[model samples]
Target: MTKKAYSKLLATATTTAIVASAFAPAASADSKDFSDVSTRYADAVSFLADKGAEGFPDGTFGTHLSIKRVDAAVLIAKVLELDTENAPASGFKDVPARAVGAVNALKEAEIAYGKNSSTFDPDSHVTRGEIALWIERAFQLEGSVEVPFEDVNNRYKDAISMMVANDITQGLTETEFGVSALAKRGDFAIFLHKAYQAMVEQSDFLLTVMHTNDTHGNIQDIAKRATAIEHVRSENPEALLLDAGDVFSGTLYFNEFLGQADLEFMNYLGYDAMTFGNHEFDLGASADGHKALADFIKGAEFPFVSANVDFTKDSTFDGLQNFEVSEDPADGEIYNGIVKEVDGEKVGIFGLTTEETPFISSTGEVQFQDYIERATEMVDKFENQGINKIIALTHLGYDDSLQYDNDLELAKQVDGIDVIVGGHSHTTLDEPVLNEDGEEPTVLVQTGEYGKALGTLDVTFDENGVLTGYAGELIKVSDLEADPVVADMLKPYTEQIEAIKTQSIGKEAAVVLDGVRENVRTKETNLGNLITDGMLAKAKTINPDTVIALQNGGGIRESIDKGDITMGEILTVMPFGNSLGIMELTGAEIIEALEHSVSAAPTASGAFLQVSGLNFTYDSSKPAGERVQTVKVQDGSDLVDIDENASYFVATNTFTAKGGDNYDVFKKAYEDGRLSEPGYVDFEMFAEYLKGLEKIEPTVENRIVDLNAAE
Candidate 1:
């Protein structure tokens, strides 16, 4: 028989006279009646009755009937009308061979799966928790309901929350739940009936605030993200979208197009809010970074907020609201946080970024304050103004122990902050982390970085602005259906990226693999050697005396994977938009910088250099500057020892020229205005230079052998 015909046959047999008799016992007396069932559930029996689900022959509704695994599968298949054409093969030895097809069908529908080892215990009694999970899987329900269960920890945590969120099951007693216990037939019926009603009356008034962080100019997956958001929003009408920042920098897209296209795309998607990320200042804190921010803000219909950033001194972000307070029509007053009525309940959202932004952000002109201090002040201000339901949208990292305090710390320290919507550090919180404060649980959530996932928190608040409860999940974008509108928005960029993908660079006779793991930091790789050689070669055109070029290993983002390397791939490998800079430094200063690089060997920092036209020996056991005992320069015929007092021409990137890589010695060299011929060394230009050489091969030889290796 064809698959559809087979499914129809199974459904007919399962609901036929014999099967109907078996199920009739469940609706008979001696069946349990669920006392806690909501009033809406009265209509549930009628709905089912209209569909010909009658009470058993005993005149007793067997509402407390123990559901078997096979029966559970059948119910789910019947409810979803799932096609079983490509179902997973049932490998359960205990399941009756005749019942295997039903189990496979349920698995194909994604409504059921074995706990482990592919064993679907077909005869095992289904528990209340299992039923709850199956109901949730069959229908995607997003709302917060009261589950007054106590003892429902870990194993059934998600299931219980889902049951509550969908109004399927309440606790056994007033405040207790035996999640693992088998549910009575009447109670199960009531639960399923309530869930069925919820599915029918699923509110369109629900507003989902889906968010992501640390995009870092990765526009390639924009359509994928847009599709996922659209799928979520289509399920709920009042969906408000937001981004957690770090949307610019990191990739060639930002370097080539700046933030204009990214901002325009975010605007097109109707993003509700965006907080500032440290990398937003990659272009510098002056007019460059602020100008981008101004352009993005001007084009965006929504607000961009940061309560901790004191932009009073900055001219560019003068009019933007740092802290906005407004009255929520559904609830009461709200401050700093945005007030939106979702499912007829008002929610308040505020935002904060890491205080370390000043140090890590390329914007040297802007300053950041203590995050907790600023956040607490904002909370107090909002609370005093009678706004109680608060959500702090934080960009701080998730870890919040006393030693590594961050957003979770902010959640714990501050009072009246209900939830902390967070980003940065790219943490994927599967479930909301509950703060240990004891007074009220603070829900902390963060979606993993790169637009790979969306964080959702479905919450419910009492009329008094107190969080009665909530349910949350990190929806993986890969699992969602793509939004066509978002796909169209990103089509132009996708076309450009696709056009560049296959374009050939100069052919390599031999492989020049990125020996990043082994030599990029502690020493030099042939790849790094080639790059620095090119930088020095380009630098020498202006100053022939330049003997050495130093490139920080961190600037080289990707390795040259084996194959016919293309120009686009090379560009991706070195996407940072840094330029070459030549400077004159005393031999002592060069030695000082080398020592700094060697000292970092213990910590394994990327600031360690891959050098060309020079070699150095260091004793890491010695402290900092004293580590480098010897330095040499090749002078055509011989390797000459460096004289500390002799001035030498050096080449490095502009990031290092400004005393980056902990090279304070260069700061003085910069102060003396000895820096010359500072021009942009597009990494692509270096790649092109490599292409011209054809058959280029580079390897990792021990350029910086540890003298202390034996020890």
Candidate 2:
């Protein structure tokens, strides 16, 4: 604005600030819900209102309204506390008088740059990443913020992270920061207030780290996540975004597109850095070894930082390098970690993935090292280079507890690390836990799997470079509005998924198959019975003696709501492509396996077995290995038991047959040649069996009972 207009605006803001300041302390921190905007952005809008930023003349915060570059520049000028007395300099060809000074101030300050030396897109819409660049530059951010945002354009990745590390912005979901989306005016006000506070606080600075883990190809809700992230970044450019890997598997999105849809969305979100999760290696031992991972890496627009995996031996990682500030992400994806500047503070970043990946997914020829050892080594490297603030982007499960892996274990074992963004174990650490149990205070945080939740961790370090204080929260992405642009981007891919998903497996369920992960894992449900029965049917086809079948709770990811069950819904519930195996187990081994199933009773475990052609009663209050109070086999409506030495045939999935979920007996049976492969794809078998019975109802008819009385 011109000098005169600037003075008038300042006077009005000062008066409003004074009036609002009186009640600001009394205003509860909870966001005031706005009907027009997505509930997810309520906090950003409410924060601005609390900070004395007036709404539109109509007395509403236009959250979904597009923000203009000129108006955005005014907010930036106000928050940076830039000088307004300078006369308007109308140098741009399309420059207007009111915005000339604001634009000039930002350009001179080197915070906002011109589209060219002669032009600034002052009237254009402000994008999430573009705003981050201006704000990061405005504050002279010298440290970095890194994330697994789907769309970290090479041009603005650094700026995006710079904003994150300074607590200037956040994300919609843990893995998305909405780089391609436009900002709103109400959010612009919130951004300025946060910047103003950060600018005013000189002795210490705050950085908000937004993180996510294990999305596993659930990109359908990414657009909604984009809206929430853009709203946050629009307000706080100095926020750090991160992902703990596993963005590569589970649904049709990955199976059909081969990570293309996921990669595009990540680029649109503008992540700074990401680590490798086990599922990233889910392409398995391929004929062309590292080709799948290579393709994923080659398409990445952000740095792929992983300190543990040795990709050097593989030609797929030929372009991998430890990135430097001078490198461009578009040239090729960088690997490992490096130092970055955020708000003039030097911060070092390192990446690590779980050593257990080979056991769970297919890493092929890739090798993994001890997380503690690699983390310590990386920390020493960063410290030796003089970067005190260290963040470890890791795929170690939140509390994996393996001596060689897990974020909690790393926190206690490593010394120099400040924060760990973690995944695996599908843990939901809604709050950042301070592991003062170690020599150095390490704060560890993780989000639950899927794009279901977003985590924000606010950390502050003193001038001495010691992490002093912190706060955090996990945001649910369900409340946000899906961005139109992101929705458009997913249209074609989504159409492909729906086409398959909607096809009738030519069957319907008379009773609801309760496939809820929590319930299925803890006890026997009708759906589990039906699934196991299907396996038994398939096993019978191979050998009539194969009478029993078992399905592990873990392999079942979702539940088919009561209705005509489509192949799509079945796949959604059982997304993993697991095959069936028919194996022999003695009566004694059967009892032992039943004991193992309930070993983690009281607390749900995916290893819990859902059985068919048999019934048993278990007391959850009993100790592990002793939970089965009774067991019996069904033989034409008759129950039989008492033959401990008799060998019986049973069917199960390849994951459990080969010892996944720690099925030691089954793995040992496989090793002994007692486990025979029937070669049945579990989901297809279920679909085939469903086709046999046009309308079937699975009944929970005391097949297996949970004896714990609800007192």
| Highest lDDT scorer | 2
Tens-place lDDT digits, model 2, residues 552-659: 999888887777888888887787757666678998888888889988986889999999988888888888887888889877778887267988988888678768
Stretches off by above 4 angstroms in model 1 are 1-43, 46-208, 285-289, 327-336, 400-405, 498-524, 528-567, 571-711
State the weakest 10-residue window (summed lDDT) of model 2: 19-28
**Alpha-carbon deviation at 116 in model 2, angstroms:** 66
Note the clash tally of each candidate.
Answer: 18, 37
Candidate 1 local accuracy as lDDT? 0.64
Per-residue lDDT over 56-169 for candidate 1, one digit per residue giving the tens place of the 0 to 100 score: 555544445676776556545544445544567756566565456656777766778876656787777888777877877776666755456777767667767877776566
Please provide the root mean square deviation of candidate 2 (C-alpha atoms, Å).
Answer: 18.9
Q: Worst lDDT window (10 residues) for model 1?
A: 13-22
The whole-model lDDT of each prediction reads 0.64, 0.72
